[model samples]
Target: MSKDLEIGKKIKTIRKEKRLSQSKVVEKLIQKDINMSRETLSKIENNNRSISAIELKAISEVLNMEIGDFFDEEEPEDLVTFFRKRNFSKESLKEISKFQDMVRILLNHEKIYKGE
Candidate 1:
């Protein structure tokens, strides 16, 4: 399959996994100053249309995902779902975010050390 088609499929998969409707995503996009229609989003998701970088970034934000996750073979765990499942308090969530940042930094350092 083409890269665009692959990306479109990933977007659709992530959106569905997040339990989000195309309309919901489009609404979020509009709040981000992106004027995409649900129909257009559907087209993009179905691989009938291509997505621009700006649209991809906006959609990623709406889906609460890092853009790089879309290109990965393994699906990322939905952090929102994780928090909801645990019923974490706001303070806990903030601490978790800080811990995640530290972990990310360590992973980056490891990659650099390994010359990856």
Candidate 2:
């Protein structure tokens, strides 16, 4: 995949994983007094335009991820599905417990049952 598409897909993936819509992001920016048009957000997500460094930083912060991690790519498999398959053992339980978020907890248990 092209770099832009990869980034775009990652952006969309993370957004959906977090149950956030573009309007929600826009609303968040509004709350923070940082505004961007929905068209601009769409373009950035569609790889139609290159996102600026400042925008990328802002997006990373808004999405609650380190900027560097955004660049990681996977094969054709869906990441949420892939992560769901990985089994968590007793050793991994302690680490998984640190995940306070609902979806993260569900995915962690899923991995544990899947015997990954």
lDDT, candidate 1, residue 54?
97
Q: Rate the local accuracy (lDDT) of all candidates.
A: 0.89, 0.74
Candidate RMSDs in Å, in order, are 15.5, 12.9
Which model scores highest in TM-score?
1
**lDDT digits (tens) for residues 61-101 of candidate 1:** 99999988778575876464478579999888887777777
What 10-residue stretch in candidate 2 is worst by lDDT?
Answer: 91-100
Best by lDDT: 1
- TM-score per candidate, in order? 0.61, 0.55
Regions of model 2 farther than 4 Å from truth: 73-116
As a whole number from 0 to 100, the lDDT of residue 43 in candidate 2 is 83
After the best TM-score superposition of candidate 2, give how far the Cα of residue 5 lies from its true spot, in angstroms: 2.7
lDDT of 1: 0.89
